[model samples]
Each structure stands twice: as C-alpha cells, then as structure tokens.
Target chain A: MPAKELIRLSGLTKTYGQGDAAFQALKGIDLSINVGEFVAVMGHSGSGKSTLMNILGCLDTPTSGVYAYENIEVQKLETNQRSMLRRHALGFIFQGFNLLARTSALENVELPLLYRGLTRGKRHEMAEKALRSVGLPDKLRNKPSELSGGQQQRVAIARAIVTNPITLFADEPTGNLDSSTTHEVMTLLTQLNREKGITILMVTHEDDVASYADRVVCLSDGNILSDTLNNRKNNK
Target chain B: MTWNAFLIALREIRRNLTRAFLTVLGIIIGVASVITMVTLGDGTTKALQQQISSLGSNMLMIRPGMGFGPRSASAGIPNFTMDDVEAIREQIDNISAVAPVSSSQMGTIYMQEARSSSITGTTLEYFSINNWTLAEGRYFSSSEATSGAAVGVIGDTVRKELFNGEDPIGKKIRVGSSVIEVIGLLKAKGQVGMGDQDDCIMVPINTVQRRITGYTSMHNIGTICVSAVEGTDSDKLVADISSLMRQRRNLQPNQDNNFNVFDTRQIADTLSSSTKTMTTLLAAVAGVSLLVGGIGIMNIMLVSVTERTREIGIRLSIGALAREVLLQFLVEAITLSCIGGIVGILLALVICLGLSQLIDIPFAFNIQINMISFIFSATIGVLFGYAPARRASRLDPIDALRHE
Candidate 1:
C-alpha cells in the first residue's frame, strides 16, 4: 500500500489564558505524519512536546489551527465526538504506567473494552490474549503494585493496544525504567509497530530512545526545529 | 453501561471499606432512627387502641356534668336517676343495653384478709353493656337483686386478695359494714393506662341503694352505661342521647348541656391521631439527619475526586466518556447510601423488636415506612452527589494526568 497522510496540522497555535496573562504553548507549527510511521518527538521541559501529543491524541483542542486526522477536522469536532474518535481510533500510554491500583493486570487491559460495552466473556478472552502478547500471561491476576516497573508498562501497553486502535500515542513510556527494562519496552513497541503496522507517535528527550523510531521531529519553543529520517537496522 | 458503572462502584466501595462506612454513617443512623420512631409509634398506637377496645368498643358513658373535670365535681351538679337510665334504654333506637351505676370506695373483710376496693352497684344489664364475663359461679338472680339481697360478684383481684386463690363463691364477705354473699367471680381485665379494671366488686343497684349506704335519694344513680347495637354510628348515638338528656333535664332552648356523654371510640381515635402526628414529626427530624448525611457523602465524594484524579485521567485518556465517568461516581454515591439504607432497615428491625419487647408494646413491621426511608436515602445520594460527580467528569485530562 502507498504511504497515506494520516495527520496534518498547519499553523497550529494554542494559547492559555488571555491578555497579559496569556501564555502561548504551541506557536505556528506545520507537521504531517504518514500512515504506519513511527515518529519520535523530542523537546526540553517547556518545549510543548506533550501538548502536541495531547492534541494529536484528541485529548485536547488547539486554540487556532487546522488539525486533520484521517480527513476528519479534529478542531471542529464536539468534545463527545473527539472522545468517540479517541475511543475507536487512538490509544495512549503515559510515563507513570497509570493502571488502576489494586486492579488485576487483565482487568487493566479490559478497561477500554468495558467502556465499549463488551460482554464479560469477550472482554475476558481479549484481555487474556493481550496480556499474553505482552508476555505477562502468568501475571494476569497480579495487581499493578505486585508487578515490576517494566511489567506494569507492559500491562499499560496491553491496555492501550487491546482495542486494536489505528494509532498509539506514548509519552515517555520508558522514562521510569532502567536501561534493561527500557530496552524491553522499546523492543515491544518496535514489534507492535512493524508486525501490526500500528502508527506510533512517541515523545522523548534522550537520543537513544529516539533512535528506535523511523523518523524524528525536534521542537523548540513549540515550533519544529528539525525533522529527519533515521536509518536503522530494519526500516519498515 | 449503568450496570458496568454499578459494578465499578461496588468495587470502589469494597476497596475503601472503612472510608465508605464512615461516609455513609449519617445515612445509616438517619434511616434507622426514622424507621424505629415510626414503627414504635405505630406499635404504641395499636397497643393503646387494643387497651381501649378492651373497655368495650361500642360502650358509652353518661356523666351528670358538662365536662369530666374538677369543676364539674365541685359545682354540685344534679345526678342522673334510674328513671333517666330507663328512659334512655326505652327511647334510643340503636341501644343494646343500659344500666344505672353507682360506685364508692369500700373496705371489705373476709376471714383474716382486709382490702380497700371500689364497690360498683349496678344491675344485670351492666354486665352485657361493659362486656364483662363470669370466670366462676353465677351472677345474682332477679329475685335476689329486686329484694335488695346482700349478694355480689368479686373481681379477680378481690378474689385473690380476700380468698387467697381459694374458691370465694357462696362465701360471705363484709362490704362497708354489711355482710354480702359472693355469687360470682369476674374475669380478669389486665391493668391499663386508666387503672386496674379488675380491682372492683359488682352488686345489685337496689342492694347498694337500700342497705349499704342507707341514703336513699330520688337521684341516686352516679353514671349510666349505654352500649350501642353493632354497626351503629357512635356520633349519631351520642347526639340521640344528648337530646334525650336535654329534654329530660328540662333545659331551656339556649341552655348548654348540663351532662356529658363519652364515646370510647373517640378517645381511641384522638389517641391514635396524636401518636401518628408525633411519629410524623420524629420521622421528619430524622429526615434532616439524612440530609446532613447526604452532605457528608458529598464531602467524601469531593475528596474522592481529588484523590483519584490520576485514575480519572487514565480512564479519560483510554476513551471513557465524560458521562461515563460521571455515572461511575454517581453510582458510587448511590450505592453507598443504598447500602447504608439496607443496613439501617435491618438494624431498625432488630431495634423495634427489642424495644417493643422491652417496653411491652406491639411490634409492627411497616413496609411502607421502610421502603420510604430507603428511597429517601437514595434520593439524598443523587441530590448531593451531582456536584462532585460533575466536577470529576469536567476535569481536564491533561491537568488530571499531571496530578499526583
């Protein structure tokens, strides 16, 4: 299949507050991501990389911009419609590995499907499959507190991808892990991106973390400073 | 979706057992106390009515005064005569029986026992009018009553006090310096609010008028006991008796009644209504506590929203609708209060049973009241839970995610 543009943003600007108190988080920015691409967004603390990901994931809206996701105008969508879009088409992961405390790993993976009104049997089956794919089949009934940090993130990944969403937005998913666990999580992400062709957009500050992606975009002061292709051992 | 929300709510409640209990404590106390108050009130009302009915459901009492107070006794009011009793029995259409009654406190002695008791003087009609029954022997015959014979029937208390459980029938006992032969034993009527009903002696009216007191006057009757036929309206009977007494007393057109007629049913109704009012007032006060309980739930829900901000963010990011989030919290609050309500109802049931037994009143399980209390507590949940649930749903995912 030919490469197709999945997301397009032109002159996107987000302003918080008004008058003298107004703070511009995202300045006039133009960016486009293609289908099946693994893109890494890099920035410092206040570079607004997280804000850009939040917008792309449909968790927020831009103040003044044209945001098109799969030919749908994201900025024009209602809050509920944006939620539906996120429900059916997008998935998210956070650095904290935010799974409900005291809930089993399998139930954590079944949260989104619960919202989708799936039956208990179907949800249990899918959740079990997802946990197995994440290599925590034996940890299905273990609470997040009982799991190691890497295992917890794997459970979060299983939760994010259990619905088979078209795109996955991961914000510093390995920020809380050591070097070995970070490699494990990065390898899992690569496998999901290559084998399943699920588009991935990740945010990171470390070059080693960014190297796993097929392309890299660096933002400074909410504007793209550089966009470059990354040569890796195996590029899809 | 609602069922899922409910299950999530149950899980959350189970997770924080102590906090949930503390949060719903107000509701628990509220519902329990309300039910207890209403149930006990109904029980008391029923007990009172039963006691009154034991006095004779269709019985009426005619006194020689306008009101039953100290003023009437001090005014030297004219007493009713046997003629008035006879006229009422013959004139009234719904009358089942009527008897002229005269009573006095008299000292009675039998062998080694001595007791001060009320000596009631009436005829055979009094037994049927007041629904008294004989436990042993027989009442005085018409020849014995007409000849003013010294014969009487002793109540159960008198029987026990004087005879000491021995058969007192056909025995002689001195009553007010006059020796009378006991012809019957009256059945025991348990002690009630008014007084002990089984601590008196019954003799013939002629026997008391002619021999015991020896003060024979034309107006010797102190009261008239009149019982209406079954299914007769008490108000109409009272009206009929009032007019008959007025005409017999020769009162002018503008004159108020110089006598009083009392209906046992009216007393029962008044007592029942007063207790019902008291029950309603107490339940309303308890309902205020339920309101306070709702406010408590709101306070805890607000804290829960703050404490679980990150969890809410995770859910929001995972495509949970804002409304779905709202429903989860609302269901949680409702579930907490409903659980409290259920436990409260069970607690109230136990309390009512124990108290009824302790206080010697009837135990009445009122389903309407229990259901009302449960539904009210749930309503309280919705009324107070809306604000905090809305706050949770309206939270921005970005800010919520950043919360610790």
Candidate 2:
C-alpha cells in the first residue's frame, strides 16, 4: 500500500531577530513523512533539528514557509486553534522527564487529558489504562522522584500516549537514562509502534538510538544532509 | 475561571504553603486596620450623638460668650441675667419655655456625709427644658421657686455622694448657710459637656440669689436654656433668640453679638462629622497598607512564576494556552487576597468589639464599610496579580522549556 502523507514542510525558513545579529536556525527545510513511519532525526548541537521539531509540533512557527498537516494549514491556525490541534492530535516526550514534581504518576499521566474537558472518572480510568500499558500499573500512586530512571521514563511515556495522538514526537526521549534503561525505553517505543501502528519521530545524536527508527534523517548546519531507510531489524 | 484552572490554582498555592500564608499577612493587616477604624469611629459617633440627644432635642444653650464651641467659654465674657431670659421668653414667636440657669461653686452641700458639689439655681422649667426626669419624688413647685423656698432636687451623684443610695427625699441637706430639703432625685444622664449632669444640685434661682450667692437682684444668670415649640424651625428660633439677646444687650447691627446661641443638633453634627473625617483618614492610611499588601503578593507571585518556568512550559507544550497559565496565577492571587479579606473581616470584628467594651462605647457594625473593604481587597488581588500573570503568559514556550 502507498503510504499516506501526514505532514508536509516546504521551503521552511526560520530566522531569529533581525539585521546584523540575525541567526538562521532552519534554512529552506523541505521534508515529508507518512503515516505509521518511525523517523529519527540525527543532529549535533546547533544543527537546527530541534527547530524543525518545534515547527512540526506546533510549539513555534517558522518565519517564512508552508507547513500543512493532514490537509490542514498548520501555519495559518490561530494560537488557540493550534493549541486545540496540539491537544487533540499531538503528543510529546522530552529529554528531561518534565513530570510535575510531588504529583503521583497517575496524576502526571492525567494532566494532558484535563485540557480536553473530560470527566474526572474518565480521565482516571484512561490514565490507569495507559499506565498499565506502559508497565507502570503498580507505580500509579508513586511520584516521579520515587521511581527509578526507567520507571520514570515509563511514566513519561504513559503521559505521552495517554491522549492517543496520531504521531508521537519524542525529543531525545531516552537521553537522561542509563544504557540499559535506554534499551528498555526504546523497546517500549518499538512495541507501541508495532502493536498500535502509531507514527513516531525522534531526535537524537546517538547512532544506536537512531537505529531503532525505520528511517534515519541526518541534519547538519541548519539543513538536512541525508535521508536513508534502515535495513537492520533487531526486534529480538 | 474554568474548573481545571481553579483546581490548578489551589494546587499551586498548596505547593508553596508557607510562602502563600506569609504573602497574605500584609493584606490581613490592611483590611483589619481599615475596617476596625471605621467600625469603631462609627460606634463613637453613635455614642456621642446619643449623649448630645439626651441633652434634649430642639434645645439651644445661650451662653454669655462670643464663640459657640468648646473654645468659646473665655473668662472675660459678660454674663446674662434673669431680665434677658424674660426678654427672650417674651420676644421669640415659637418659644415654648425658658429657664435661667445660674451655677456657682461657692455653695457646698453637707449632710451626714458631705462632699463638695457645684450648685445650680434655675426655674422649675429647667427640668422640662433639659429633659430631666425625676427618678423619684417631685420637682419643686413654682410657688417654691417664686417664694425662694429652701427646697432642692438632688442629682444622682449628689445622692450617691451625700446619701449613698439611701432615699434622701424630705431630708435636709445644708447648702452654705441654708439647710435645704431634698425634694426630688434627677434621673441619671451619664455625662454631658464638662461636668457630670448627675453631679449638681438644683434649687430655685431666687433661693440661690438670696442664700447661696450674694447676688440678691437676680441680675446674673450663667446660661439660658431655651426650648422651642415642637417642630419649629430651629434656625429661625435661633435667629430670633440671637436678635432678642442683641437688642437686650444693646448691641448695634454691625457688632458681633456678645451672647452665643448654640444648637444641640449642630454640636452633634460637628462632632460626628469630625469623627467621620478621622475615620476616612484612617482608612486611607490603611488603604496604603492594602496597596503594600498587594505589592507583596505581586513580588512573591513573580518569583513563583520564574521558579516554575519549566512547569509553565510543560503545560504550554501539552495543549495549555497562554491564558490558561494566566488564569492559574490570577486565580492563585485572588485566592490569597480573598483569604486575607475574610480573615481581616473576622479580626476587625473581634478587635472592634473588644475595644468598644474596653473603652465603654457602643459597638456598631458598619456593613457598608466592611463590604467596601472586602471589595477593595479583591480588587487589590486582581490589580496586583496581573503583572506577574502577564509575565508568566508572555513567556516563550520553547525558551521556557529549555530553561533549567
């Protein structure tokens, strides 16, 4: 089956400030990703990979460009409308497990659903289900500070997938974890992709982490340097 | 204003429990001080007005002085006499009753137990004009006043001093060289002006002129207590009385009259207005503290916003709008100040009632002032809460997220 296009970014250019001090973060970036595809964007510091992710995630807008997602104009939507889209159709995981401190894991997972105007009962039920799927059913009442690094990442993963968005944007999702816990988190992401068919886009500098994605896109100096499909599969 | 925002606001406040409590201290003091001053001032005004009204309504005190207020009684003011009282009684159109009151410290009372008390000599109409009621027995008859009989009505304090709560009616109490029979007890009037209304002895002006004082011609009366007919224009009565005094005193039209006619209502009004001004001034000063309280809340809230920058970023990244973050802090601020307001109201109530009892004045709740204080407190919350909330909302999500 021909893969359906989910996001299209064309001639996207972003510049900070103006005149002498202007810094170009993203220059003429054009890329397309399809439904159910796991793409890992590889870049070093100052490579503008995060800028592309920000534009795609609706966290910020490009200075001059066109960005369309699922036939809807991403650049023209109002701030509230973009917030609504993010609430309904996007999810994010960060390098820093940005869980609200002193809050329980269940409550952390339920935070995003609160903006959707769901009933408290529904929110609790769904949060419980998401935590169980992330293998954190017993850790629902524990706080992030009380959990190990791997368990905390699992809680963060539960929070990311609680809304069931079409695409999951994970920016260095396993960056803060040890090597063994990083494998555990990557295995969870692979299981979610294979089992639920949810699309995933991650940004990382580690080649081992990038190898988990089906395709690797490398960025350097504010532009994409290469895009290639991965051949090796280590589901075991 | 949404339910989630409200819940979030409470969570933030709970997150910094001790800080939140401390931040509201300024507001608490502000509201309490302002409301307490106003409430107590209102009570004092009521108490003062009541005391003035007890002196009798629609009555004027015509003293032999140029000025009318407390500062008017200078030592050199010429005295009015019985003749002037008669002239005013005869000339005024709405004049109901007039009594010539003459006071002298020269006479002292002696009984089984003796104490020095001022003696006042006046006509029987003085009882009616001053609204004095007889606690027991009866005032002296007009014949007793006319014939200069040695009969007297003892005030409450005189009875307490000389009689010690024993019935003194029909008993003899000596005044100077004369042994006067106590015929009546004047009802207690708490206090009025410079002297206790219940501390003086009342006898016939004629008797005082002949016996207690050497002024035998009845030519000098200290003040004339004039009562107008009920519902008469007090201003007109005062004008008529002033004109009659002027004519009797032989003053020309251009001269400031020697005698001052003062209204009880006017005195009460002046006293009450000054108290009101004082209350307003106190409230304004306390209102500055309210502002300071608001500023304190603002300062703390700004720090909290900066401290929670990453949390704000997380909420923004997960579908929260700028206004949602704005609502969080605004609601938090309003909660802080509203708590302060309610607590202030409670504290003011306790302190006001306590002080009123301590100082022996009536305690009254001024609902309007309390409500205004509360509303002002809420307004302070909004006013001071805005800047910090705006700063929080205007933060760039990406930059905030990247903040360590």
Candidate 3:
C-alpha cells in the first residue's frame, strides 16, 4: 500500500523578541512527512533544526504558518487541545534522556500512560512490554541515577513507545551515548520502524547518526539546504 | 486523577520529609495551643459549677445589700429581722425552710486551744437551707433556740482548731467571754466560691443578740436564708421573697428595694457564661497562629514549586494537563497541613490531660472544637496553597523543561 501523509508544514516562521532584538528561528519552511518513514534532520548551530523539532512536537506554535497533523489544524488548536493531541498521538525522546531522577525505570516509562487514565495493572503490563522491547526488562526497578547513560536512554525510548503513539520525535537521541551504545539504540529504533511501522522524525548533528534514517533533510540559516534519500546497507 | 495526584504528592513529601515537617511546625503549635486553651477553660467552668452547686440545692441567699460587689454592701441598709423570716416561712408558697442569721467574729477558747472564728447565730432551719449535715451531736431543742439558751453548733474547721478532733458535744467553749455549750458538730462541707463553708459556728439568733452583742433585740438578724422545694422556678421565688421583704420592711412601691435576694443558680449561670467568654477569647487569640502557620506553608510551597520546575516540565511534556499539575501541588499542601492538624490535636489531648490534673480542674474533651480546628487547618492549606499551585500549573512546558 502507498504510504499516507502524516504531517505537513507550509510557510512556517518562528520569531522571538521584537524589532531590533528580534530573531527569526524558522523562515518559510515547507516539509512533508509520511507514515512509517525514518527521517533525520541535520543542521549546525544556529540552523533552527531544534526550533523546527519543537514546533512539530507541538511544544510550541509557529509565528505564521500552516501546520496540519493528519489533516488536523494543529496551529489553531488551544494549548489544552494540543496537549490532548500530543498525549494520544505523539511521543518524544530527548538527548539528555530526561528520565526522572530517583524514579524507577518502569515508573518513568509508565508516566505517559498515567495521563491517559489507564488502569494500574494495564499500565504496568504495557510499560513492562515496552521495557522488554528496549532490552531493559531487568532494569525495571532501577532508578535513573543508578543506570548508565545508555541504559537511561533505553528507558527513555521505552517511555516514548509505551503509549503506542502514531509519531515519535527524537531530538539527538544518541547525542550523549557512546559509539557502541549509539549503534545499539539506533538498531532498536530501526527495528521499531521497519517492524512496528512507527513513523519517526529525528534531529542529529552526527553524519553516522543520520545514516540510520531513510531520508536526510539538511538545514542552514533557518532554511532547508538539502532533502535527499539515503541508501544504506541492511546491516541489521 | 485526584488519586494519582495524591499519590504523587505523598511521594514528593516523603522525599523531602524533613522539609515537610519543618514547614508544618507552625500549624502544629497553633492547633495544639487553641485546643488546650479551650479544653482547660471548659474544665475550669465545670469545676466552678460543681463547687457552686455544693453550696445548696435550689437555695436563695437574702442578704442585706442592694446587690453583690463592693459598691453594693448593706452598711447603710437596714438588716432583715426575725419577723421578716417568720413572715416568709408562714406566708410564701413553694418555700421549704427559712432562717434569720446574725454573725460576729469573736475569740473562742476551749481549754488550751484559742482561735479567732466567725460565730453565726441562726435557727435549726439554717442547716437544712445551706445543706449542712452534722457529723455528730444533736441540734438544740426548740426551747433552747426560743429562750435564748447559750448553746452552739461548731463546724469542722472550728472543731479542728478548738477541740483538736476531740468530741466537743456538750463541752463548753468560751465565745467573746461567754461560755456556750457545743450541741452539735457540723460535717465538713469543703470550700466554695465565697470562702470556707466549715469555718463558722452557728447558735440561736437570740443567743447572739442577748449574750454576744448584748443587744437582746429581735431586729439584730443580718440576713435570711430561704430554700424552695424542688422544681420551683427560682426567678419567681426571688420575686416572692423580695415582695415579702418589701412588704414587711414597709418600703414604698416606687422606691428601689433596700435588700437583694440572690438565686445561687443565677450566680452559677453568670459565672459559667463569663468563663465561656474567656475561653472563646483565648481560642480566638490562638486562632491567629493558625493563619500564620498557613503563611508558613505557602512560603515553603512557593520555594518547592521553584525547585521542581524541571520535574513539572517533564510531567507537562508527557501530556499532563495544567490542572492536573495544580491538583498535585494543592493536594500536597493540604495533606501536609492536615497531618499537622492531627498531630496538634493529639498533642493538645496530652497537654490538657496533664495540665488539668496539675491545676486541679476536670479534663474536658470537646469533640466539636477539635473537629472545627481540623477543618480550619485544612482550609488554611487550601487558602495558602492556591497561589503556588496555580503558578506551577501555568508554567510553560518548553521553558519549564529548559529550567535548570
């Protein structure tokens, strides 16, 4: 079956401050993401890739743009409505891991499902399955502080996928991980994309990290520099 | 959702156990002191009522005064006479007993024991009216009271001082240079609000007039004691006695009566109400501290919100609504204060029990006040916790996640 369009952004612009102090982070950007696609967004410092990620994740709104997610006018949604949309349809992974310190890994993974009002038993079951998928089944009771960087990131991945979201936004998911741990996390993401058909939009600075994606979009000075498909060996 | 917030709040408080305890200290002290004050006040009022009731049952004291207090002394007013007491005894309805009393402080001696004691002279009805019961010996015969016989009844204190616990019946004790035979020894009536009830001796009014004061007149009676039958409205009784006294004294209708008839029950009520007023005042003063305690909680909660900005960001970013975050913080504050209130109530219980025993008052536990205090403390939590929780909920997820 042909892939379905998941998200579209047209003429998107984000400005901070005013007049002389104003800085435009995204200037007239147009992009389309398809379901089940693994796309990497690459940019240098001051290139506004992170800004685009923020707007796409619904953590922010663009100054003037049309942002449609599954044909829903997300830009016109209220803050609470956007929250509900993010709750049910989107998941996020951060470079810092962002696991709550001193909290058990299982509980951290179960955080999103709490807002979804799932029963405790059901939430526990789903969170455990997600942890097992990320290869941290035995680390369910370990706190973030007690876990290594790679293990913590795995816990973050488990949390992001625990809700079975339609789209996953990973902002430098492997930035803080070692090369070996990076390969392990990238392989896990590849399996989830190719097998589970979960669409992913990732931002990265490293070329090798971008190599995991099926397509690469390079940004420079708040505008797209290149959008190209990548051909990689089926190493997995 | 509320339950989840409650659980989260409990975990947060547990994580910072020491800080939470310190934050609630003010509330604890506030609740404990208010409860203690109100409890002790109730105990004192009860003790006072008990003591006053011991004075007499349904009794009235007709004193030769306009009213009680220093300004109302009957020094310029005429004293009640035996004829007035006689008229009440014969004429009034619902009346049980009547006695005309005259008292003088005099030196009494029995063998080597010498003491200055108050000597009251009244009829046999005085003992019944004042609820006095003799421990031993017999009261005087009617002839002894009528013919001015030199006989006396000594109270417990007088017996202890003059006779040294020895049976003094039929023994002679000199009162103001007159030797009087002790016919009866009164039971120990303990103490009341006025003074020691067992400190005076009672003889016939005629004996006091003829022997002690050397007056030999029937008009020397200082006061009259009257007791009504049970179930008689005391207000009506007072009115009856006043009217009788006014008629016997030949006072004009327009004139203010020269004497006062005091119902002991009314005195008890007045005294009890005053005690209640004092308790309310003390509780109110203690209530001020509860408000201060609420402010303390607010201050710490504000600090807590600032410290947990990043944690709030994480929750917000994970699809938690603003009100959910607000509920979490609000529940935490209310839980903290309610815990403080419970601790305070328990502390007050212990303190009231110990202090009541120390101060010789009844220990009164008022559940109503305790409940009011608890609800008030919880309200304080809500009142003070609102601003901080609202601030937490209104936080921007992106900015909050960026918070260090």
Candidate 4:
C-alpha cells in the first residue's frame, strides 16, 4: 500500500484551567504520521511535547483542533468509542513502564486483548506471540517486579502491540532504563517498526534516544522549532 | 476481559490474606449472630409448646382466685370439697372428669426416713384428668375415697426417693404423722406447668382432709383439673365452667369471675405467638448488624479505590472500559462477603448444635433462613461496593496516573 497517513492533526490547541487561571499547553500543532514511520518528538521540559503526546495517545482531548486517526475524527467520538479506538487502533507505552504490579508478563500482554473480548485460547496465543516478539518469551510468567527495567518495558511493549493496533505511541519509553537497556529497547522498537510495518511515535528529551528514529521533530514553548527527515540515518 | 486478570485479582486477594480476612469478619459476625439467635429462639418456642401439649391439650385449670394475683384477706374463698366436685360432675354438660385437690408440702415418710414431698388429696378422677397411668398396682377406689380410708398412690419420683429402685406398692408411707398404704406407683411424668408431677404422693381427698389436716373444708384447692368431653368446644366448655363456678360462689353478674381458668391449648398459643414476636425482634436487630457490615464493606472499598488509583490508571490506559473496572471491583466485594457468609453459616450450625445439647430447649436451625441471610449479606456487599467502584471508574486517567 502507498504511504497512508495513520494519524493526522491540524491546528491542535489544548488549554488547562479557565479564565484568569488559563494555561495553554499546546499551541496550533499540525502534524501527520504516515503508516510504518518511526518518528521522534523532542523538547525541553514544559515545551508542549508531553501535551501533544497525550492528545496523540487519546489520553486527553485538545481544547480546539481536529484529530483524525485512520480517517475517523477522534475528537468527536464518544467515551466508549474513544476506548474502543484506543484498544483497536492505537497503543501506548508510558515512560514509567506502567505495568500492573504483581501481574505476570503474559497477563500484562493479555490486558488489551481482554478488552477486545477474545477467547481464552486466542488471548493466550496472541499474548505469547507478543512476548516472543519483544524477546522476553521466557519471562512470560514473571511479574514486573521480578523482571529488569528493560524487561518490564518489553512486557509493556508486548501489551501495547498485542492488539496489532494501527499506531504505537511511546512517551519516553526508555526514561527509566540505563544506557545499555535503553539501546536494547530502542533496537527492539526499530526491529518491530521495520519488520512488522507498525507506525511508531516516540517522545524523548535525549538526542541519543531521538537519533534512533527516521524523522525528528523539536518543540519549544508550545511551538514546533524544527521538523527534519534523517536521510543519512535512513540510508544506513 | 481475560480470566487471567480475574485470576490475578484473586491471587492478589490471597496474597494479602490478613486484609481479606479482616474485610470478611464483619459479615461473618453479622450472619452468625442472626443464625444463632433464630435457632435458639425457635428451639425454646418448640420446647415450650411440647411441654404445654404434654399437659393435655384440652385440660383446663380452675383455681379459687381473681385471675392470678395476691390473695386478699376479705375475699371469702369458696370451699372445694368432695361435695362440690360431685356437684360439678353431676351438673355440668361438658365436664368429662373433675378432680378437687388440696395439696401441701409435708414432711413425709419414704422407706422409714422423713423426706420433703408434696401430698395431694384427690379422687380417682385426677388420674384420667391429668393423663396419669399406674406403673404398678392400682389407684385408690371410690369406696376408699368415700369411706375416708388411708389408701394412696405414690408418684415415680417419690418411689425413687423413698424405695431407691425397690417396689413401693403395698408399702406403707406416713404423711404428716398419718400412715397411708401405697396402692400404686404412678408412671414417670417428667414435669408439667412449672410443677414436678413425679414428686407428688396422692391420697383420698376426704381421708387427707379429715385425718391428716384435721379440717372438714379445704379453702385453697390445688388447681381443679378438668378435661372436656369428646368433640365438645373447649372454649365453650371453659366459659360454661367459669359461669358455673361463679354462680356456685354466688357472685353478682357485674363482678369478675373469682376463679382463674387457664386452658393448656390457649397458653400454648399465647407462648408461641410471643416467642414468634421475640424471634422477629431479634432478627431485626441482627439485620441492623448486617447493615453495619454493608457500611463496613463500602468504607473499605473506598479505601481500596484510593489505594489502587495508579492501578486503575494503568488499566484504563491499556484500553479497559470504565464499566469493566467498576464491575471487577464490585465482584471482588461480593466475593469477599459471600465467602464470609458461608463461614458464618457453618459457625451458626456449630453453635446451634452446642446450644441444643447445653440448654433444655430444642434449637432448630432453619436452612431457608440461613440461605436468605447469606444472600442478603452478599447483596449488601454489592449495593455498598457500587459507589466506590464508580468513583474509581470515573477517575481521570491522567490524574490517576499522576496520583501517588
């Protein structure tokens, strides 16, 4: 298939609070993410990067804007519809590796598939495959506390991708990991993006983490400061 | 969602065993207390009814007094003698048998030793009226009663106390310095109407009145036992006997009947109804404890919601519907209470068993009531758990994720 836009946003603006206490988090953001693209969003603290990620991940709605995923306007969707969209179309990876404590890796991966109402057999099959893809097949029965930080993030990734969603949204996916584990997680993400053709959006403050992406976008004070395609990295 | 998540939740509950047990304790105590109270109350009522029935269903007691009150000095108590008993027997239509008894606790002789026992002076009609049967020998004859002979029947308790397992029939016993031959030994009558029938020694009424007490007329007759004729309306019989006694005493129409008449069946009904009322009142009080248990569940669920804030955020972010989260927590609360209720029922059963063995009353454990209580407690868990579950479900994912 031709390069189709999986996520599209136009003139997106999000404001917290109201009247005198009003604060704008995102200012007229316009962006499009194509299918199978690995894009990185970089910004300083309080630079609207996290707000854009939140909107992109469907965790929040923009104060004023149009957000469309796969040709469907997400801002106008109902609460249940948004939940369904998140389950069937978009996946999220948090910086804290927000895996349920005391839950096994396979069960964590099966969480999203449970919302999809899959049968027990089918859920196990999908969760096993997802864990295997993240290179943690042996850690399926281990809880998050038992796994290394990178292993926990892999379990989180397995959970996000188990539903085979249209877009994967990762916010500082390696923020809690050391340099070695960060590289290992980023390599896994790169391999998943290239081999499975899954669209990836990553947010980070580290330039080294952003360097793994095919395209990099920088934001400052609620405005996009740069949007550049990495032709050299793409060629390599 | 997946059964795995439910399994995980259950596992988590098991892991925090102490908290789970504490959470269920309220329900356990509430259910157990209800069951114990109901079982014991039912048993006592049944025992009382049985005791009343054993006294003869149609038997009525008539005593010379204004209802049940203290005896007054100015009240001219009518004498109930062999003549009055004969008069009532010959005059009344519903009277099947009449026994005019004069009783006193006398220092009597049994096996050559003096012992304290009741002496009742009455006719042979007393045997049939009180459903008494002879264990050995025969009752006093009408000739012996009329001739004022000193023949008497001894109850089983008196026989045991006096003879010490030997036969007392044809043996002579002394009552208040008067020697009387035991004509028979009565069959064991456990106890009836607050008095031990087995401890009494019966003699001819005229003989006891003339020889032992040295009185020709007895003022206070130990309750006159009357049995109604077959197919006769007992209430009407009682009313007729009351009127006849009043006329015999020469009371005016406006005056209250000077004698108190109590029917065994009526007393039984009254006792049962009162017991039913008491059971209902105790159940209502126990129900209040169940309500408090529900409130305890709600309070704990609220705290659980607060504690699991981050977990709720994680689940929501992973595509869990708000209603799904609500339902999971609700199920958890219900599970806790249902487990507690089951334990309570078992405890109640054990308690009922212990009570039946320990007390004189028969305690019955109604399975239907126990089941109803169990279901009621589970429902309370659900009803109370809803608010906290809803609060957790409606939480903003971003804010919840940020919650410490």
Please provide, for model 4 over B64-166, each residue's C-alpha lDDT reduced to its tens digit, 9 standing for 90 to 100: 7666646522367664555556667788787788888888889888666679898888888888878788889998888999988988898888888888877
Rank candidates by lDDT, best first: 1, 3, 2, 4
Highest lDDT model number: 1
lDDT of 1 by residue, B84-124 (tens): 98899889989888988999999999999999999988999
Candidate 2 local lDDT, B1-404, one digit each (tens): 37889988897778668768866776787788778887887788788877887788688899887765775777766788888888888778887899999987644555557677888999988988888999999999989999889899988988888887678899898887778899999889888665687888999999998877767776679889988888999998888888878888889988887778888778777878887897778777877776776677666655665557778788888888888877887788788888988998999999998999998789989888788878877677666666655755566567677765
The numbered model that scores best in TM-score is 2
| I-RMSD for candidate 1 | 1.3
**What value does the lDDT take at residue A68 in candidate 3?**
94
In candidate 4, position A85 carries an lDDT of: 76
Model 3 interface RMSD, one decimal? 1.4
Find the candidate with the highest DockQ and give its number: 1
Residue-level lDDT of model 2, residues A4-28, one tens digit each, is 9999889998898899999999999
State in Å the error of residue B335, model 4.
4.0
Q: Model 1 chain A — which ten-residue stretch has the worst lDDT?
A: A227-236
lDDT of 3 by residue, A102-137 (tens): 789998999889888888899999999999999998
Clashes of each: 0, 0, 0, 1
Poorest lDDT segment (10 consecutive residues) of candidate 4 chain B: B72-81
Worst 10 residues of 4 chain A by lDDT: A227-236
Comparison by TM-score, 2 against 4, better one: 2
lDDT of 3 at A64: 94
